[model samples]
Each structure stands twice: as C-alpha cells, then as structure tokens.
Target chain A: MENVLELKNLKRHYPIYGGVFRKQVASVQALDGIDLSIRRGECLGLVGESGCGKTTTGKAIIRLDDPTSGNILFYHKEKKDGVDIATMSPRQMKKQGIRSKLQMVFQDPTTSMDPRMLVKQIIAEPLREQGGLSSRALENRVVELLELVGLTKDHPMRYPHEFSGGQRQRIAVARAIATNPEFIILDEPTSALDVSVQAQILNLLHELQQRLQLTYLFVTHHLLVVKYISHRLAVMYLGKLVEIADTDDLFNKPLHPYTHALLSGIPIPDVQHKLKRIVLSGDVPSPLNPPSGCRFHTRCPFVIDQCKSEEPVLEEVESAHKVACHRKNEVRKLVYDQFG
Target chain B: MPKLIQAEDVVTNFYTYEGVVKALNKVGLVVDHGATFGLVGESGCGKSVMVRSMMRIVQEPGQIEGGKVVLFFNGDQQQEAVDLLQQSEAYMEDLRGNHISMIFQEPNAALNPIMSIGDQISESFLFHRKKEMSKKILEDLSADDCRVFLPLKKLQQTLYTIAADNPKSFILIICSKIPILSLWQRRLKREALQRSIDIIRKLSISNPSETVHRYPHNLSGGMKQRIVIAIALACHPMLLIADEATSNLDVTIQAQILELLKDLKKTEIASILLITHDLGIVAETCDRVGVMYAGNLCEVADVEKLFQNPQHPYTKALLESVPKFSQEGRLRSIDGAVPNLVSPPSGCRFHPRCSHAMEICKQTFPEEIEIEENHMVACHLYVK
Candidate 1:
C-alpha cells in the first residue's frame, strides 16, 4: 500500500510569554517528534486523551495549523506529484491544487457550520472558493453532495439550526466533500452526538468511504468508535505517538503499557469478564512541562529506571507493529501473562 | 420489597422558543430499597429528565406537568409514605436534601462557587440536624442555666449562618486584627469548621483537612465528582439520583466512581436511580436496566438478561451499535438517527431505525409484552 500522507519528525511548540518585559519564559511542546503515515483509502485512527496533540496532528496534516518543524508529504498519484504541504505558501498551495486534495470535518457541528448561511450556501461556499465553479454549477454540486451524505435536496434551503445534531453533521460532511477531497481529517466527528446517532454517522462515514474511496485521519478519544472505523490505530500520549499498528493487532497485542491501560479502561458490557483495570493515579501532566524520558512515564505502570532517563524511539517489534518503549517486550509479556 | 421511590405517570416538557420539546412522556419508574435501577438511553431521550423529575430539580422552561412522586420512609416511628409531589413548596424543601438527593453530570458546575467545600457538605447536615443538636445541647438545663446558654447558642448560631449579616459589626468585633474578642470568636469558628472537616473526611477524600479549605477549582474532574458525591451522600438520603454522573469522566475514573457507588450502596442501602447513555456502564453497575427511546421505555430487564437476549428492536439495535473488540473490523452500525422527540415518528418510535421493522410496526404501537420472568419488551416483532 502506498502512503497518502507521511510525517517525519513532526514537532509543534508554542512559546509562553511572561514577566514585565514580556520575554519568552518557556515553550509548550504540543507535538514532539511524531512520525506517522496514512495509506491510500485507509482510515488511520489517532486515539488519545484531551491535550494529547491528536487534534493538532490532524490540523497539521490539513495545513489548518502549521507545525513548527516537520515534513508533511502529500502524494497525489493522479498527477504523479508529491508536495511537502508543511512549507507550502497558503496562496501557492491553493493554486497548486493542494487545498482541494485535503479537507477537515470539525467536532461540533453547530459551531462549525455558519448559522447565518443556509445549508446550500454553507456547502457551496467551499466549492465556490476552491473549485471556482459557477453559481448554477455550485448549486448543483451542493445538491449532489447533500444527497451523497444522506440528506434531501430540500435540506439546502434550510438553516443549520433547523436540523438535528446528526443532520447538521451530515451537512458538515457534505461541505467537506464538496471539493471531492481525497483525504479528510475527522476531529472527534461524533463526540457531540448520542450513541445511536453516533452509530448512524459511523455508518455514513463507512458507506461514503466505500463509495468515494476516501482516506481519513480519524481523531477521537473513544476507543469503541476508533475500533469500529479504523484500519490502523496510533496511540498517543502527552505529545508523541507511543504505538502504531494494525487495528486488530494493536487491540489484541498492545506493546506499550499506556496502550494496555487505555484499552482496559474502557468499560466492557459483559460484567462476567471483568478486566483488571489499571487505574492510573493522578491527572494528565501539563503539556508545558512534560516529564523527562517518556512523556507517559509519569502515569505509566511499568516505569523503570531506564524509562525514567532515556527517551525511547518507535521501533518495529513485529510485522507492522511499532512501539516506542524501553520495555515493549516486557510489557507485552506482562499483558499476555495477565490477560491471556 | 417495598418501593423506596415511585414515580407515577411523570410528564415533563420544555417550552422552548422553537416549540414544546416533550422531554418526558408519561414516564413511570420505581426504585426499590437497595436496588440500582439503570435508565439507559441516547442523548435527548429524556433519561436525565426522568431521573431529575424524581428530585424535582428540572430547571426553568422545563416543568413536571403531571406526576406523583411518592417516597416511602422506612426509618421512622410511624412507617409513613408521603406523596412528595403533593407536599407544599416549603415542606418539599425540608425533604429534598434530607430524604432524596441528586448528583448532576458536571460536578464543577453543580457545586457552589463562593462557598468552601466543607461548608457545602455541612449545609445539608446543618439543615437536618441543627434543631436536634440544639435540643441535645439544651437538655438537662435549668431556667437560669438555659438563660446562660442562650447567649452562647445565639453566638454559635450567628457563627454558622452563611448569610452576610452585620458585615460592619462582624468585621470590627469578630475579625479585627487585634481585637480582644477576636481570639475567642476565632476559637468558636474553628470548632464549627472542624465539624465540617469531619464530614468531608467521611467521604474518603484524601487530606480532608487541606481539601476542605480549597475551592472546587483546585480539584481534578474525578476529585470534583467525588466531592459532589460526598455532598449528595452527606445527608445519607434514602434515594440517590445520579444523573449522568460519570458520563463526563474518562473510563478509568468512571470505573473507580462506579466502584465507589457500589461500595456506598452496600453500606448505606440507598436506592440508586442511575441515568446514563452508555450501556457498558449500566451492565457493570446496574442490577436492572430500562432502555428508553423518544421518551418511552422500550425495554426493561435484568442486566444479564438484557445483554444476553434483547427482545426489543431498539434495545437490540443499541446493543449491536456498540462496537466490540471481539468483533474488530466487523462492526456494523444501526441505520438511522433517533427520531425527533417533539414530533417523533408515529406508531413505533424506533421503527425508522430498527433493522427488523415491519409494515405493522410503522402504523401500530406495540404493547409491553413479558418475554420471560422479569423481562419486558415493547416491540411488534415480539408480540407473537
């Protein structure tokens, strides 16, 4: 499988200001040297808690938020061209057709969609701005996009407030797909919705992906939703990717202790099969001053002397299974001994 | 067992600018003594409203139009059951925190902003125990002794009062930097503060002496929720209504809170009416689960039975909609969104989204049928 999007040593840091002179006091490393890849037509799930930089990673991929330093390579097979979107100028990138190849679906549908604009205008605005289509052609494309996302043609005339949460999200999806982008970044797309409606949206995304062959970078905190939609999964902590592997392999044989703890934290329906949940003490540390060595070592259960001093790099231990932990094999053995 | 809390034909509605949102439609549920009755549903399904209605805590624009909330008191000389809905507003106030209490979803927002954590927990104890304590303090006292104790009692009462009475006099006389009476007043206040600290420590909070002094903003999400739980359990109310108490928390914190509630249940024997959207939480904590859809209870069954064999199409759809790790890469979602509550779909509310929806299901509402012992489902497919 060819890589559609790749990140090499990505880092995004925001400098803090303080004192009477407004001098730089310190820096908050939001993304610390992340290396990841999303294949063509594949859904890559970025799972992490709040403030873990998963959303930042998605925004970096779509160029909505520029990374401090990294290489973001977007491979466009149709044109047989590769563009490093990280350094591309906004206007130059738009003219070079990079904007039309990638888009984003925000988490909250109500806030994301323009209240003053009608559904037709909201969906057509992207097409008008990016594709530069005529008014009539834009209207036609809006109708088609709405229909593709399971909305009626009449929906275009209505304002966003008139629709339910799920319907509003469908409108957001229509707007994201208006330009027929090859890749979409779904940032907690269904977190604001009910469970049943979440199911509907998940199904819609699945159906749309199958029909349009769309690739996705799905960012969410819910493990179940990630398990449902993702082909590959990446577990992130603080600001770095801890583990990345095939969805099934990651869930069944998680190499990192953080990954195991995250999976066990999820409450399973069957009470009979009780998980020996590793209740992590204390809150997630501030991103401003993350701990030394591994960022997750503060909350990690299998913390060791080496894990406290030496930073571990992501190394492939099995086929397509990569883990960034000093004791990945030891953690795997512990998981097997207890769970298996 | 006798019902601890019984809500009969509760109808709650919100008059929004758009329209009248039918939040709760003739909802009826019972919470037996020491039993945890789980109300499971998707968001906007009125599960929270139904549980909130029990405590009469539904906010403005939303009112309980018609309902009877009866609470049977087991620990009394008379063994009487009172109709909580029929009580006067003043009398209902006395019953609220002492007899029935509620813990909301967001703990930070639910707690008082200006008050210390100790004072908030002590308010419930003061409200219910003040008169009794006063009597106990005045017991075996002569008329002259009572007169002597009067000034001390008045001073104690003034010290405990939360209202800002006589701010000038209080500042000059009680809290002055080097006043003669300030030292004695400080000692008196310290004694009252210690009582509040003892109550907070009873909730198993770490370092209650230190925690009681700080405001809610300094606490973490789980610690804040624990404080809220502590406040709700302060009075040892007969029925505890947890309205999405753990929904905002992460899974690890949620499991710990659930375990805490379970332990509290065994010791206190307080009936819990848990309102939640996650079926997994219900399966772990609840003994009996009631699944709701569009303001209707679609199914009610034991947690084990409901998980093993869900009879209602809506319940089955909800269970199947949850992605399981065992079935990774093969999970299938339910087809359509939940119907609008204001103008819900006619006949069966879940028919539009149900997989086994029939022609009859779209036109006729199904009656609740007993599939087996203690299990009831409302679906046309299970009628025969």
Candidate 2:
C-alpha cells in the first residue's frame, strides 16, 4: 500500500515571555520530534491525554498551525516525488490543489459552523472555494451532500441552531467531504456528543470511510471509540510518541508503561469484566518544563535511576510493535506473568 | 437500609414562549442511606430537572408543579420523615448546604473567578457552620491563656455568644454595619478559613495553604473540581449530589476522583445521588440505577441486572448502542433522535423509536410494575 502522509521530526514551540523587557524566558514544547505515517485508506488512531499534542500533530499535517521544523511529505500519483507541505504557504497549497485533498472536522460542531448561514450555504462554501460551479450545479450538489449524510433535501434550508447536536455533527461531516478529500483529520469529532449520538456519528464515519476509501487520522481521548475505528493505534505522552502497534496487539499487550496505564485506566462498560487499573500517581507534567530523560519517569510506577537520567528512543521490539521504554522487556514479562 | 430520600410523582414544567415544556413527567426514585444511586439519561431527558426540583433550585421559567419530596434523617426508620415540599423557603435555604449539598457540572462556571479559593470554600463554612464556628471562637476568647486585648475580647465574647444562639440575630446585624465594630468577628472568620484548609488537605491536595491563596484561574480543571468537592463536603452533609462532576476531566484524573469519592463514601458522606450519562461510570460506582427517557422513568434495578438483563426496550437499545472495546461488525445505533420535550410524543415518549412498542403504547402510559424482587419496568410489553 502507498503511504498517504508521512511526518518526520515535526516540532512546534510557543515561546513564553517574562521580565521587564518581555524577554523570552522559555518555550512550551508542544510537538517535539514526532514521527508517524498514514497509509492510504487506513485509519490511524492517535490516543493521548489533553496536553499530549495529538491535536497539534493533526493541525500541523493540515497546515492550520505552521510547524517549527520538519517535513510533511504528501504523495500524489502524477508526481512521483512527494511534496513537502511543511513549507507551503496558504496560496501555494491552494494553487497546488493540496488544500482540497486534505481537510479537517473540528471537535465542537456548534462553534465551527456559522449561525447566520443556512445548511446549504455551509456545505456550498467548500464547493465555492473550489470554484467553476454554476448556481444550479451548486444547489444540486448541496442537496446531494445533505442526502449523503442521511438528511432530507429540505434540511439545507434550515439554520445550524435549528438542529440537534447529532444533526449538526452530520452537517459538519457533509461539509468536510464536500470537496471529495482523500484524507481527513477528525479531532475529537464525537467527544461533545452523547453516547447514542456518538454511536451514530461513528457509524457514519465508518460507512463513509469504506465508501470513499478515505484515510483518517482519528484523534481522540476516548479509548473504546478509537479501538472501534482505527486499524493501528499510537500512544503519545507529553508531545512525543511512546508506542505504536496494530490495534489488537496494542490493546492485548501494550509495551510502554504509559500505554499500559492508559489502557487500564478506561472503565469498561461491562459489569462482569473487571480489569485491574493502573492509575498514575499524579497529574501530567507541564509541557513548558517537561521532566528530563523519560518524560513519564515522574509518575511511572517502575521508575529507576537509569530511567531518570537517560532518554530511551522508539525502537521496534517486535515485528510491528514499537515502544520507547528502557524496561519494556521486564515490564512485558511481569504483565504476562500476572495476567496469564 | 433506611430510606434517605424519596420523590413521589415529581412533575416539573418549563413555561416557554413556544408552549409548556413538560421536563419531568411524574418521575420518581429513591436513594437509601449508605447507597449510591445513579440516574442515567441523555441531554434534555429531565434527569437534571428531577434532581433540581428535589433541591428546589430550578431556575426561572421552570416550576415544580406537583410532587412530594420526603427526606428522612439518618438510618432511623422509626422517625417521621419530613415533607420538604411543604417547608418554608427559609427552612429550605438552611437545609441546602447543611443537610444536602450539591456539586455542579462545570467547576469553572460554578466557582467565582475573582474570589480566592479559600474565601469561596470558607463561605460554605460561614453559611452553614456559623453557630459551630462562633462557639469555637468563644472557647478561644475564654481560654486561660488567651492573648486577645482585654477591652476588645470583652466585646467579641458578647458578640460570639449571641451569634452562637442565633446566627440571624438583629444585634449582630447592627454591629456588622458599624465600621470598626464589624472587625470583632475576625477570629470567627479565621476559624472558618482554618476549617477550609483542613478540608482541602483532607482531599489529599498538597500545599493546601498555598492552594487556598490562589484564584480559580491559576488551578487546573482537576484542582478546581477538588475545590468544589471541598465546599460540598465542608459541613458533612447527609446527601451529596454530583451532577456530571467528572465528565469534563481526563480519564486518568476521572479515575482518581472516582476513587476519592469511593473512599469518602466509607468515611464522610452518608449517601450519594450521582447524575451522569455514562453507563460505565454507573456500573463502576452505583449500587442501583434508574434509567430516564424524555422526562419519564423507564426502569430501576440493581446495576448488575440492568447491565446483564435489561427489561425495557429503550434500556436494551441504549446498552446495545455503546461500542464495546474492539467491537466487531457495524454498531447498532438507536434509530431516532431524542424527542422534543416542548411537545413530547403522546403516551410513552419512547414509543416512536422503541423496537418492541405495541399498538397500545401510543395511546396511554404504562404503569410501573415489579418484574423481579428489586427490578421495576415501565413498558407496555412488561405490563401484560
């Protein structure tokens, strides 16, 4: 399978100013040296806590936030060489047709859409950006998009606030795919919704992905939702990728200590299936002054002197499983011995 | 276990411009002493309105039309239960933060941004613990090794003695208006602040003294929630109502808070009424569960039975809709959206979307019946 998107050494830092002259005291390392790849027509789930930079990686790939340094390689069939979107300006991206191929659906549907415009105008905004469609064609396309997202033709005449949360999210999905994008970034798309409505949106996304052969970078903190949608899973901790593996492999036996703790923290809906939870001692450290060496050493239960002094690099411990833990072997043995 | 609180045929309505919104249609439930009761429903399903009506804190344009809320004191079944609906506004005000306190959903919105954390928490102490605090101040003033000035201590002693008898005394109100004389109760205020610090420390917050001095904006979401919990637990209320208190927090922080609440249940609070939409939270924390749909109570059962063998069609569909970990095939979503409460569907509001709805379901509401020992279901399918 061809790779749709590749991120190499991506970094984003926001400088904090203090003192009399407003000098730069320090910088928050929001995204520090992230390396990831998304294959064509595959959903990659990015799971992390609030400040782990999952949204930052999504924004950097779509150029919502400019990266400090790195290469975002986007491949096109006609062009054998992949284009570096990291350096592309807004106009350059539009001119090269990359803007239409990549799109994003925000977390909150209420604030992302305009209240003054009707649903027809909201969906037609993207088609109008692409240009060259007549008024009749645009109207037809708006009606088509509405039906595609499981809404009636009359829905295009209603404003955003007139619909419920589930219906509004459906409108947001309609707008995202209006441009026929091949890859989409869903940033906590279903977090703000109720469980039943969340299930509806998840099913819609699943059906759309299969029908269009679309690739997804599904970023969310909900573990079960990620497990349901993604083919592969990536666990991030304080702006760095700590583990990556197939969804089943990672869920069954996560290697990194952070990944294991995160998986166990989730409260399973079933009453009979009780799994022992590994609750981290304290809160996540601030990104402004992250802990030295391993970022997770401060809260890790199995921390050692070596872990506090030296950083471990991400390396493949198995065929398709990668972990960035110095004590992966010992942790794995202990986990297996206890559970088996 | 004796009943701590019970509501009978609670009906709440919102008189909107469009029409009347029947938010709660004869909702009824019970919470026993030393038990955690979970209310599960989607947004606008009247789970919140039912609790707010019981608390008598429903906002303007909303009114609790007809209901009886009976509150029993402690575990004594022999004692006569008090009808809270017939109580005066002043009596209810005293009962709010003293016997029954509530923790709101959004901590940022619930807390005042300008006030320091210490002052906000201590305010609860001042409201409900005034007599207790004033008695403590009297002890300090009358001690053998007292350090207060002689003349000032004499005036403070008289003031605190009156305060201990009646917190709403007229003489204290007059003295509070005087410029320099108002400072006589400084020792009492200090006592409340000390109690606030102790409660914050009890929640396992490190550096409670420093944390009390900071404002709400300086703290994280989890820390603000802890402050809210501190205020709710200040007076050792009999019932603590947590309305989606942990929904906005991260999973790890949520686990910590849930664990804290479980521990506190064994030590401090008598019973808890938890309102949330997550079934997982209900399964993990609640002893019994009540499922609400469109302002109506559909089912009430033990947590284990509700999860394993759901009786109501709506409850069955709700349990099926949630995605399990690494679930196979397509998810079976509930077919329709929640109905509009302003002009809700006739009869059972869930009939329009229920898979097993019968012809009689659209005509009249079903009476709640006990199918098993501790399980009750309100559905036409179960009525026969």
Candidate 3:
C-alpha cells in the first residue's frame, strides 16, 4: 500500500530567550526526531500527555508550522506525485495544492472557526481560496457539504455560535472535506465535547473517512478515544515516540514502561475489574532540558544505570510492534506482573 | 450513620440577560461521613452548582429557589445532630470555616492574592479559636519570674492600655520597637505566624518557611491547589465539597492532586462530594457515582456497577462513547448534542439523542427504576 503521508526524522524546536540581551538560553525540543507513515485510508492515533508535542508533530506534518528539519512527503496521485512538502516554498506549496491535499480539524471548533462567518461561508472559504468556483456553484456546494455532514441546508445561514460544540465541529469537518483533502489531522476533535456528543462526532469522523477514503492523523490525550478510532497507535513522552504498534497489540502488551504506566493509569469504567494503576512518581520533565539519555528515565520505575547513559532508538520487537526503551523485556515483565 | 449533608429537591436558576437559565432542577444528592461520592456529568450539567449550593457560594443572578440544604453537624457536647441550614447567618458564618469547607478548581482564584499564604491559612484559626488563641497569647506574654520581670509588668500595663481597644494595632506598633514593648509583641506575632507556617507544612508543601511567605501566584498550579486544600482542611470540616478541583490540572498533576485529596479524606475522616465532568477521573477516585443530564440524574450506582452494567441508555452510551486504548479503531460515538436545560425535551431529556429511543420516549418521561440492590436509573428502556 502506498503511503499517503510520510514524516522522516522530523524535528521542531522553539528556542527560549533569556538575560539582558535576550540571548537564546535553551530550546524547547517540541518534536525531537520522529519517523511515521500513514497509508491511504488509515487512522493513526497519536496519544500523549499535554506538552508531549503530539500536536506539534501534527502541525509539522500539515506544514501549519514549518518543521526545524526533516522530510514531509505527500503522495499526490492526481498531479506531480511524491512531492517533498517540507522543502516546498510557500507559494510553490500552494500551487502544488498541498494545503487542499492535507487539511486540519483543530481542537476547539468554537475558537477555530470565525464566529462572524455564516456556516456556508465558513465551509466555502476553502473553495473560495482554491478559486474556480462560480457564485451559484459555490453556494450549491456549501449546501451539499452541510447535508453530507448531517446538517440541514438551512444551517448554511446560521453563524458558528448558533451551533453546539458538536455541530460546530461538524461544520469544521465539512470545511476540511470541502477541499476534498486526502489527509486530515484531527487534533482532539472531540475532547471539548460531552461523552455522548463525542460519540456522535467520532461516528461522524469514521463515516466521513469511510465515505471519503481519507487518511487521518488523530492527536489526543484520551487513550480510550485513540483506541476506538485508530488502527495503529503511537505513545509519545517528552517530545519522543516511546512506542508504536497495532492498537490491540500495544494495549495487550505495552513494551515501553511509560506506555505501560499510561495504560495502567487510565481507570477502566468497569467496577469488577480493578486496575493496579502504576502511579508515575514525578511530573513530566520540562522539554527545555529533558532527562539525559531517555527523556522518560527520571520517572521510569525500571530506570537503570545504562538508561541514563544511552538513549534507546525505536525498534520493532514483534510484527508491527515498536518500542524505544533500554529494557523493553524488563518493562514488559513488570507491566504484566503488575497488570495481569 | 447520620447524613452529613442532605439536599432535597434543590432548584438553582440563573437569571441571565439572555433568559432564565435553569442550572439545577429538583436536583438532590446526599453525602455521608467519611465517604467519597462523585457527581459525574458533562460540561454545564450542574454538578458544580449542586456542590456550590452546600457552601452557599452560588453568586448573584443564580438563586436557589426551592431547596433545603440540611447539614447535620454532630454537636461538640450533646451528641445531637443540628440542622446547620436552620441556623442564623452569623452562626453559618462561624460554621463556614470550621465545620463545612470547600476547595475550588482553580486554587489561585480561590486564594487571596495580596495576603501571604501563611497569613491566609492562619486566618481560619483566628476566626474559629480566637478565645483559645488569646489565652495562649497571655501565657506567652506572662513573665516566668515576676521579681526579675517587674519592668516587664510595667511594660505589660502600658501595652494592655494600648491593646484595650485594638490588640492588632497595639501589637503592630510595639513590634516595630518603641524600645519598651518590642520583645513581648515580637514574641506574640511570631507565635501566631508560626502556627500558620506549621499548617502549611502539614499540607506536605515542599518548604513551609518559604512557601508561607510567598503569595498564591508564586506557586505552581498543583502547589496552589495543595495550599487551597490545606486551608480547606485547616479547620477539620466534616464534609469537603471539591468543585471541579482537579479539572484545570494536567493529567499527571491531576493524578497527584487526586491522590493528595484521597489521602486527606482518610486522615481527616471527612466525606468528600467531588464534582467533575470527566468520567475517567470519577472512575479513578469516586467510590459511588451519579450521572446527571439536563438538570436530572439519569443514573446513580456504585462506580464498578455503573461502568460494567449500566442500565440507563445514557450511561451505556457514555461508556461506549469514551475512546479506550484497548478498543482503538472500533470506537462508536453517540449522536446529537445535549438538550438545552432551560427548555428541556418534553419526554426524556436524552430521548432526542438516544440510539434506542422509542416513540413513548418522545412524549413521556421515565420514572426511576431500581435495577439492582443499589443501582438506580431513569430511562424508558428500563422503566417497568
């Protein structure tokens, strides 16, 4: 299967300024090296705590913010195929139809969408920017898009504020799909919504993906939401990928201690099944100067001397199961012993 | 066991500029001594309002129209439980800091900005135990040997004359050293301030001495929350109402705060009425849970039972909608948004969005049904 989107050795760092001269004191290593690929029609869930840089990784891929360094290859089947988007000039990227090819559904639709814009204008803004749409044709397209996203045609006249959070999100989705993008980054699309409404949004996303055959890079902090929506899952900590595997495999057997602890920390809704929660001792380390060797070593329950001296590269231990840890086997044993 | 707090048919409504917002409608829940009861709901579900009603903290435009919030305080002597709500405002004022305290979600907002953290914490002791405190002050001021302290006695007489009307003012001037009353006044203020510093230390704050002097804004979010918790627990309240206490924190910090609250609950032997929108937090910390929707409790059950075999359609949908790591890629979401509480749906408030909604659900509200010994749900699907 041809990969629709691929990120290779991506890194994005924001420099921190200090002192009288405002000199560059240190850099927040937001996205330390990351390598990931999303196949056509696949949904990859990126799960992490706040400040783990999962959102930064998504922004980097969509070129919402330029990456400090790396390659972002977009496989556009229609036009010039296999374009390196990272190196493309802003004008060239627009001309290459990169923006329309990869769209983003932000975390908060209430804030993301303009409150002043009517639903029709919000959805049609992408089309207007892409050009070549007649006034009558654009209006018709907006109505169709609204209906497709489970809204009435009359909704086109309403403002974003008139809609509920879930409804506004649907309008955002409608806008994302207006350009008919091949890939969409859903950044905590349902986190702002209620559980029941969250379910509706999740179902809508799933249905939209199936109908459009679109690929997704879903970023969220909620593990359960990731589990339900993602075909494969990646666990991030301190701006680094700790584990990546088939969602079921990762949940069944988490190799990285951080991933294991994160999974165990989530309290299951079932009352009969009591979880032996692995309470990580310390807070997430600051990104400015993450721990030596492994960024997770400070809070890792199974930290050893070697873990502090050498950083572990993400390596595949089993089919579609990759982990970055000095002692993957030891971590696995500890997780199973505690959870199983 | 006596009920620590009982709210019967509580109705809180806010008269906003737009319209009358029925924040809470006939909402009722109970908290017993030494138990943690969780009120779980989505945003705008009135969980906060219900707990805020207990503290009489609901602000202007928000009126508690029809409800009796009965707080039964076990008398210090007679062992008889007294209805705190029936007491006068002055009595309630006295009881606020000492009997039933509250910890809010944002610690910075809850704490005083200008006051030193230590002074704010000690204020509780001052308000509740002023007589006992005065006795301790007198003991500290008394000289061990009257003969050697004759000059001290003369100074005490002058200080007493100055303190006859305003002790704080008299002590403040003497502590600045008029040369005569410096030592005694310094000792007095230091003793009171030391007790405040001691409470900060008891909350497990890293450095009590430094933390006591600093204002609320200087501390981290978690540390501020801890300070607020310390102040709330200072007077040993029988019931602590935590209103969205951990909602503002990050997940790891949230875990630590929840753990701290749990530890405090056990040590103080106080009941906690935890209000939150996150079901995951409720599952992690709450022993029993109540689900609210559009100003109505749809279900109430033991945390385990609520999660495993939820009888109400809303509860089942809520559990199903949560995306779990174990069930990635197979997530199912419920359709539709929450109904407006002011003018809720005629029949079942949740019927408009329910997947299993029937025709009768659109016209008639379901009565509460007891599915198990302690589990109760209000949904047409379960109603006999």
Q: Please name the candidate that would achieve the greatest TM-score relative to the true structure.
A: 2
For candidate 1, what is the DockQ?
Answer: 0.46
Report how far off residue A49 is in candidate 2 (Å): 1.1
Each model's C-alpha lDDT? 0.81, 0.91, 0.81
lDDT of 1 by residue, A80-171 (tens): 65779898999988898889889899999999987999999898887778755788888888888989999888888999999989999999
* Candidate scoring better on TM-score of 1 and 2: 2
Write candidate 2's Cα lDDT for B1-384 as tens digits.
Answer: 789999999999999998999999998899999999999999889988998999999998999999899999856564678878889999999999889999999999999999999999999888888999999889978999999788888888999999999999999998889998898668878898899999999999989999999999999888899999999999999999999989998888888888889889999999999999988889888999999999999999999999999999989989888888748987888877899999899888999998887889999998999999989999989754
List pairs with backbone clashes in candidate 1: none
- Deviation in Å, model 3, residue B285 alpha carbon: 3.0
Please give the lDDT score at residue B381 for candidate 3.
80
Best by DockQ: 2
RMSD of each: 4.9, 1.7, 4.1
From the highest DockQ down, the ranking of the candidates is: 2, 3, 1
Ranking of all predicted structures according to lDDT, beginning with the best and ending with the worst: 2, 1, 3
Place model 3 in a CAPRI quality band: medium
